[model samples]
Target chain A: MAFDIFHRHKLTISGTQAQALEMARLRLIWVGMLMMMGYLAIILRMGDLCLLHHKSTAMLMGSGAPAETERPLRASIVDRNGNILAVSLRMASVYADARMVHDPAKLAQELAALLPKQNEADLFKRLSSGKAFVWIQRFITPKQEYAINALGDPAIHFQEEQRRIYPDANLAAQVVGYTDVDSNGIAGIEKFFNKRLAAGGKPLRLTLDVRVQHIMRQDLAAAIKTFHALDGTGLVMDVNTGQIIAMVSLPDFDPNHIGEATNNEKFNRATLADYEMGSTFKTFSIAAGLNSGKVHLSSVFDASHPLHIDQFYIHDFDAKDRPLTIPEIYIYSSNIGTAKMAESLGPDYIRDFYQKLGFMQQAPIEVPERATPLYPSPWREVNTMTAAFGHGIAVSPLHLVRAASAIVNGGILLKPTLVMPDNPDVPPQGTRVISAATSEKMRRLLELVVASGTGAYAWVKGYDVGGKTGTADKNKNGRYENHANISSFLGVFPIWHPRYVVLALLDDPQGTKATHGFSTGGYTAAPVVGDVIARMGPMYGIKPRMYITRDSIEKSMKPYLKEYKEGQALASVSTDH
Target chain B: MRKSTLLWLILTVFCGIALFHTSQKVHDERARLAALNASIAHEKQSIRVLGAEWAYLNNPRRLEMLAKTYLHMAPLSAAQFIRIDDIPLRAAPAAAPAPQTEKIAVKKISPEIQPRKIVALERPVTMKTRKPAPPRIFKKRAAPDGGTATARNFRDVMKSLRLGVE
Candidate 1:
């Protein structure tokens, strides 16, 4: 039985070995089949590539017919009224790979002659440096490219590039800005609207008017030259829409040759330059009091002596005494009275009010270049006194605008913007700081400044002009400069209806003989506002005002005084901090 | 069995299908590329048109005329406008119109002089030439020859338009 079992086991083992051999044979057959299939596939693909197609993909790529790129042509930029500000023009940029060049001297001579800017010897020396590649020229003119192409050297290359051409050399330079060699925005609205410029389907339209820009630049340039100003800035904004129509900065750059401009020439002063904007801050002070129900158009404060505090005195160019009315104080721009009113409103309320007015924060705009207004980290009493007269707290011309805009644009606080906001369907939301009644009264007072007070020279007969003049001594270290002054004027025109905000500022302006050795805001800046208004008003179809009636203003003031008097009698005695 | 012939047949069919697909891919890519190029070309053409318009519009003489004609805005004066303030207010007309008499003048005409009268009217040659220009010399002869025929043809056409030609 054991011998029989052993024979069966041997048979079973042989069967298993045979099965394994069969499996190996099948595996070999499968491998052969796979190899045959793969060989067939490879042969077919190769024939299809080398024979059937007649051209390889690599070869096709080397040839220019179907290059794997479909770059969109760049878009043009226009103004609000469809004036073309900046537009992308097609051109060629030339470069050369030294590694590919056979004759360095020959290539250099040809390139140098084609581009007269470089010497042939210098070009040859650069090519002989054994570098892999060298840039011959960027943003070459079409004629230069043609002259280059006539050389017909194998090593020479031309890359298609976009060149932004500015039609108006210096008009709206700060507004349109200039593009870099690679067509990237470097400053102004171009820098702000970089992504939109790149996305190429739709043109970016600004609120700038080229004609208006020319008139302004022409006027402003004359002003800068006349005043012996180190720098100057001017802006016109649509108070209704917050559209910056035209913004000009002195020492302006040429967009066509923007790369050649210095850092100072490129700075946008109207929007980015910051300074102690003097008594212009007073507009906010009175607005705060009116909003707080503690003051009225008839409110009085003695302006004869400077409002004296611990080591600080706030007084105007000419002092008044015996309790002048609010309109008279503003018309005269009495810094002493303004400081007292700011005290009446107190620090907390003023700080909060400035905060709501887009001050004490980074200015809002699409452009990356924006300066934050310098406010006291700890709001104090002395800070309040200086801030009231616009000394301690430094702000940009834009801040002065944001504050003054509210006073002119009814009692509502509208955040100023660029880019003529997308929603034409909806007007921008603004917070009401003072009642319409107070706003009406303020308009009358501001107009009275142009008509009868410090800004008297700014009065143009036909226009219902209203504006405030601001003159501050520049701070060298901490204290204000007695000689070097920043003179600025903020104005709202057709002041009865108020549609536009025009601001003019001159930095370190020297007094001229015509100005009677005066560089104050009224003398230096107010006249510019008046000229801009007279020039722009008729064009905008704002018919000239035949008369400056004081009826509506007086009516608004009577009601304002009675309400404020009752509130003052019953209000909290101590709201100051 | 003729295995090589069968293999050749399958390979031929496979090669044909692959070629069709590759051809289709190339054609589709070409169509896409053409469309993209066309679009780029169209954009470039449009920009050229806009630039031409801008150049024409921004001509200095044109702008000066516009400033004068529109808005009573004149060349900036030293007396009316001092050099102290030049902040630009861009609410003004950017490029003034052609200042056509039509553009600036109101249409309220006084009925006193009955406007300028038309002196004379040019008479057309009536199948006869008093004075025929060189280009129309042949036309004068042709017109005389074809006048009766044209009048009859027009009568027939009018009949045809009335649906009676058939």
Candidate 2:
């Protein structure tokens, strides 16, 4: 009907009426176009919000409210088996805009009441300082944050920060280290791998097995308490891979409160403290002798009496007062015999041997705390003799462990590492330090030490345990103190197929009733190693032999044993106990 | 001309309805998507908190203390472990038929003695009178030793339960 009316009007309309109708039609068309454009814009905006620009918008939202969704700036540090040792948890830190405070003194007093550690006066000074922004406190607990948030202070604001938390507390404190409030690593592996960890991809997988670490720490702590030692250190490493399964230092500080720790607590004895690891170094000397082809298992060194070299007299700890075969020298830990062997090899060979064992330089580990070996200058004859018996030269326990690994693990001196290698099964192809035959003989000698000699306490019942003991007098003011001794034991288990090297040391250990008043390595450190092996062996999948015995070790060392003359009287001196 | 106008009107109406429905569907889906994204963010936050809590709970020191206090279980030692093949085989039972019931307490023989409580409570059910199917997912398994896997009775199940409790 409208079309019929329009048709009739069109037929009867004059030019003026037609022009008015045309203007009205054009206005309606323009209005319709404008409405369409508005709908199209709405559609485009919906598309953008849903698809094209959604991520950018979400990012904007996330940045504005980062406390809830922000990822950690630093990745977590986990053990080899994916157990978390250190993690960066998102935490709200309390900060203050001092310029925005209404009444600085009043706000400061109120905040001081909330934070018990802060005095009102100090807080007032901080708040009234001319600085526009100041940090009131950092890494506050959620409860404290809530308490402060409840204050409704306009001047105080919370900033989201990543707080490094060591969930295991002091378990691997010296290895994992601690980060500063600003999330900068200052010590240990955290400092060493700061760049990669801060790059933030996957969790940093360390080679440490926290279970084994706990075992070592427990035994070392117990030994420290029992012997009344000043401090103790323990380490366990895989012989083939050089992966540190466990590293422990007693008097350790909780990484969460790294700032509160004293210098003594922060001292990493395992890696940083260089000690004259007395008789344990004899293994290296004898191995060097064997490797240089100057000595064999039957090589004899007359250790009947002390040898006077200039003003210094090199005396055997357990003087046999008779000729001892090379293996006997190792098993008995005859210092004079080892020094004699070193004298024959000369300073050049001895120094070369030490260098080959990676003992002449700083420890090649992933931790920042490392000690450079106190290598004797000029390689003089006296220095050579003392270094042979492990007196004149000093190296960290980690250095000894790496060299020990070379002696028993097929003569390959692998670089000790804290991070688990990508391929752990393939052993590192390290520098050849000794012949395979020499390494085998070294294993036999070490086993013999645990079997019938000073390391008898380190003998685990089921495992093929083998190691040497070192009881060194503490050097004080350039003189060796008789009473103060660092007793240490370096042990390897399943010696036939060497796997783990465990080293335990007690600093200034005192003898106890349990130890029969003997503070030597054989008495103090060896038993701790035995306890660790007994507990950690089963966990490492080492089966205990119930029926099999190691009588063969005795048979192999028979050539190294000598018969005493009837006229020669032997005095029983138990120096190592 | 009239047909074309009608056709145009139909096309315009159809197009208008299609666009309106499409927009409505898009709006509904966008709302759903936003809700899902919000929930995912919430869950991620929860997961992060839970991970931290898990790490704290699994701390070796705390676990060791707990084990020392409550469990009293020392770390597994080498001596305590044995290989599976080390275990010896058991001896065969004597070739004799077992008695159906054994008396726990002996009494004087009397004709007037009442039946024991255990013996009086049990009754045998024939296969025909028993329920056809058991609630458990049991298959008609042929025993490896060439015996039929017969369906156990309710009495047997109850006896097993009692044994479990004991």
Candidate 3:
């Protein structure tokens, strides 16, 4: 059989037939080989599917859920107590495919009815413009979206967009700030932490307490109305941590309606606008004097007459007309006494002291709307005298509050912060601006002011309130206007162990009948500070020491106050400047 | 050889059927998982909206207004607070002996006290069983609106409720 297979076979057929038969045999062999190759390919593919491609196939089939929804475009902003101040919500922005819209006039009418703010004529123009897409309304309410959807038009559609919402409205308008339509932070802390907020994780908690903010705003607003002031600002700060608990700027605009706000309403007076802070600066000058050992509480300064320095004459608003002890000088708000005290300390020492207290530069706070303090350059002798009386220099209310906090909070000058720290239990450290002994003496002297001096109106029974009142004539075009003045008060309560520092300022306050035509700080702003402390004392759970009496405060300050009379007919109304 | 070929053919058919069934089941599960994910996303969005609304509703200014209108309450005054030590202690009760015994018994049963050790294993165990105490009876009192017969009137009930009787 093997020999026969090797032998060639002969065929009895014509040449063409034999050739055709040979071709047919070759084609059949080719077809059979091709079929074997196809089977082999199928086996290889089956093996690949069962082993090499298993993971890919399983992933494709099993992971059918859509990729995780995108994270919120912006994070929320909360108060110190975790109350929502600002949030970002996914909202429906309705638009139209103008090319597909039919009866532009009719559709415009329907949309105008649905959206009261959208004008019918404008909608018709947008619809008839033949543009492929046009926005009908942005950030519509859910009810409006529902109503529009009921129209059931194929041309109309909605695109989900992120919108920033300020839930507290005008309560914390200047601090929480507001965002633009594109969810971009525009002002206040919103503008300051734009990048961190855009990253979108946990909420950005601020140091503000909304309840305190409400109280401050309500009280400040009432004071503004009562005194007929043009504008006002208020601030509250933690003495140790420098956390701003409440900040209010009057004539503030609602963040929810940013477009309707005027430029004046948008101005953050507390942190941005600088003013000649009048008598509030006395707290700093007295602290500097006491800290430098240049002037003790018992030291006497001649406030009997105006003192001449260069072309300017420094005079007390209500002249004491006698050599005044340091405590009596502070309580009387004597400008001449303060100027003489600064003169004794010299200009260099005063400038360096002010620099250490952070008065020479912009206030160090979290908000971006901070103002650089305006002070005389070259530190002239006259500038030192005027500055000691809170003139020839200007600073924001925030700066005053921060400095006052340092003076009352054991001499630690902490940088004010609007954002709460991750661990609020640990207080941020501060630089020492004065000796603790000096701060204690300053506390006693301040309490004495409220006890029997010009700031007598600021006294709140049992709260041991201590403060200084200032009434500064506003400078306009380099000239001081007498009638137009800034009245302010700096208050610290439970003065023995201070916890909070509050400052209230009124711009161009007019005197009312109750004030007897005197719009000085003692008559106008001191009462406001008193009211704020009276209410805040209870809200903060600070137990009032009924044992603390005016007599006790005066007795403790007796060594510093020479010939201080008891129940001295509450110092004349316009006694402080 | 024919038997083995037949056996392999049957096995391949069974494997094919099983693979198809599993893939089909996986597809159904993926669809359900997708649906759940969608609903979860929706619920999260709604919760954010509700949070915003809650903040707006709880705004201090609004709360103050509501409180002024509906609640007869004023802000806490400084006079309301007093030191804890200022509160005088209550006078001694007339029936103090019974409470004294109970206090001693509580001390005896305290976890801090260790049980006495047995000196000898041969001692017989004595189990003392006390008599069960009788259950106290609670008597139903008349409704604040005089009686249930007259309490059917809704206005009267509302008036009584407003007066804080119920």
The TM-score of candidate 3's chain A against the true chain A comes to 0.88
lDDT of candidate 3 over A342-446, digit per residue (tens):
999976877888899888899988878999999999889898888888999998998899999999999999989998888878878999999999999999888
| Candidate 2 lDDT by residue in tens digits, B32-129 | 77777778766864766667667777777766643443332466655555555444332222245344222312222222333332222122222332
Candidate 1 lDDT, B1-166, residue by residue in tens: 5999999999999999999999899778777776776787768667765784565467344565433322222433222321222222212222545566434322322233223322112222222212222221111112212332222344543443334111
State every prediction's TM-score relative to the real structure.
0.70, 0.78, 0.81
Lowest lDDT 10-residue stretch of candidate 2 chain A: A564-573
lDDT, candidate 2, residue A117?
Answer: 73
Give TM-score values for chain A, per-prediction: 0.82, 0.85, 0.88
Residue A253 Cα positional deviation in candidate 2, in Å, after optimal superposition: 0.2
Best by DockQ: 3
> Worst ten-residue run, lDDT, model 1 chain A?
A568-577
Better of 2 and 3 by TM-score: 3
| lDDT pick, better of 1 and 2 | 2
Error of 1 at A303 (Å): 2.4
Give residue B108's error in model 3 in angstroms.
36
Highest lDDT among the candidates is held by which one?
A: 3
Name the candidate, 1 or 2, with the larger TM-score value: 2
DockQ of all candidate complexes = 0.04, 0.23, 0.43
Provide the DockQ value for model 1: 0.04
At residue A304, candidate 3 shows an lDDT of: 89
